[model samples]
Target: MITAEKIFKSFGTCTVLNGINLAIGAGSTIGLAGPSGSGKSTLLRCIQGLESPDSGRISREGYPGFMFQDFQLFPHMTVWDNILYAPRVRKLFPRAYLEAKADRLLRHLAIGQCKDRYPTNLSGGQKQRVALARTLILGPDILLCDEPTSGLDVAATGDVVALLKSIQNEETTIVVASHNLDFLVQISNRIILLKNGSIGADIVPQELEDPIVHLRGLCD
Candidate 1:
């Protein structure tokens, strides 16, 4: 559903993505893993149009939604407001539809009771689910997640994993950029290792041992 060709991006003198090329098929879950400053986040931003490439091209089909590494929910807004904000602003759907979708997402994500709470009142896991509900409420065709399990504990991470897998289907493409290799392996059909602004390795996660070792080595 997304194709990036020889994508090159830089910030002043520092290059973040160099000669990046990849094609993500529809309904696939692709994981991007690497150490700090490896361009994982930068690549996701370019795909989401949050950043423009200095050169090369990125083409994508359908609507794209981004979930930031840090949950960027408005602190003043309750979960209900935060989840419905984007569709409400875009008026992409009827008010009744938006509200119904928001309600369903909150329930599906197991955060129904938290709808009345503010971000400040949420725990890390609750906040993550709320953020996910907000993103999923829009029914994005392609979901770009940055560190979906960043601050969650093991149990919470497991919950996030299950949730992601449950949402996978025949139309949505999921791309996750994270430092958590084990987590990625669990959810990603394909894992890509990024190093120094380039794709270091890309492999299927079937034989998890070797891929995990290789990915960890690159990060180290």
Candidate 2:
């Protein structure tokens, strides 16, 4: 669970987030939809502590794992190494245990054969899965994904979306920021429309007869 109260963020003379308030429940999938520059990415960064809000408070019940729009994999490291790096550094578990976990995650993500390959050698979808494995390996309670399907083709997008949905359970909360309204609607129980750095509308998928029309009305 996560709660943000009166959150505000600014860059130079531009105000990106204005009194943004949010309450994300456990196991809920929240889709943040907005026009470009509406602060969806900024909000996600703030929640994950990658960026600080100028004012107000954010309280999260547990650790959050962030997946960037660009798969930030270590180009020099093999896939296996990239997945194990964080856990190895933290030393929360034994090396053997972590290695086994990495194997399981790679297999589960259907990227088992990529373990020996470098990030540069993998496809966009493969890289995305590798990034996902790295994040999920940390055992995060909240998953924060920024443009999770940003650069993929339609087929790749479908693959990533299906993988994400399959992995989500009653114990993990997932927040995805994306421009793909239909994809968001398919995966998220709640869709939040943001306009000019503020919440414009919050509605469930079934409540809208036409999501695209409603989204255009609110954002455009």
Candidate 3:
């Protein structure tokens, strides 16, 4: 499980997260929905330890893997190399073991054919898959994604959503921050609405008849 207690963050004089508290259960798929600059990305970064909160405590059982909004792939490396980078850097496993894991992940994501290609050559969805594969190679207990489908078309968004859903089992927790309300409603079991750096509502998507309308009410 992951818990955040009275979390607060700021950049210079601008406050981002303000007295935020949350408890994310294991194996749950949570969607963080809010307008731009509502601290969605900041919260995810804090949870992943990429950014530190100015105050409050965040506790979790294990480390999380973060998938960036821009699909932060190494432009100079091939897909295979990009997937192997973290494991090789940390020396988590032998080269052969990491290679085998990468091969499996690439195949599972249906991007095995693009292993030798660089990020520049792949489509938006393919790039996202590669990024996801890279994160998955580390076997994180939690996955934090920032705008996983920000620029994709409907088909591509569906593909990414499907991929995410496939990996959400009994052991991994997934938290996604996205502007795609429909996508979130489709994939996430719980939805957290944020406003002005605080949680406005915490609801189960299945309980809301019109999620978009409910979300609009909260934001407005």
10 residues in a row with least lDDT, candidate 3: 155-164
| Worst-scoring 10-residue span by lDDT in model 2 | 151-160
lDDT of 3: 0.89
TM-score of each: 0.92, 0.91, 0.91
Candidate 1 local lDDT, 30-71, one digit each (tens): 999988888988999999999999999999999999998788
Which candidate gets the maximum TM-score versus the true structure?
Answer: 1
lDDT by residue (1-220, candidate 2, tens digit) is: 9999999999998999999999999999999999989999899999999999999999998878999878899999999999998988998788888888888877766789999999999998889888888988898899998887776778767776787787688989999999999889889989998888789999888787997678778887
Question: Number of clashes in model 2?
Answer: 0
TM for candidate 1 is 0.92
**Candidate 1 Cα lDDT to native:** 0.89
Is candidate 1 or 2 superior in TM-score? 1
Each model's lDDT comes to 0.89, 0.88, 0.89
- The best-first sequence of candidates by lDDT reads 3, 1, 2
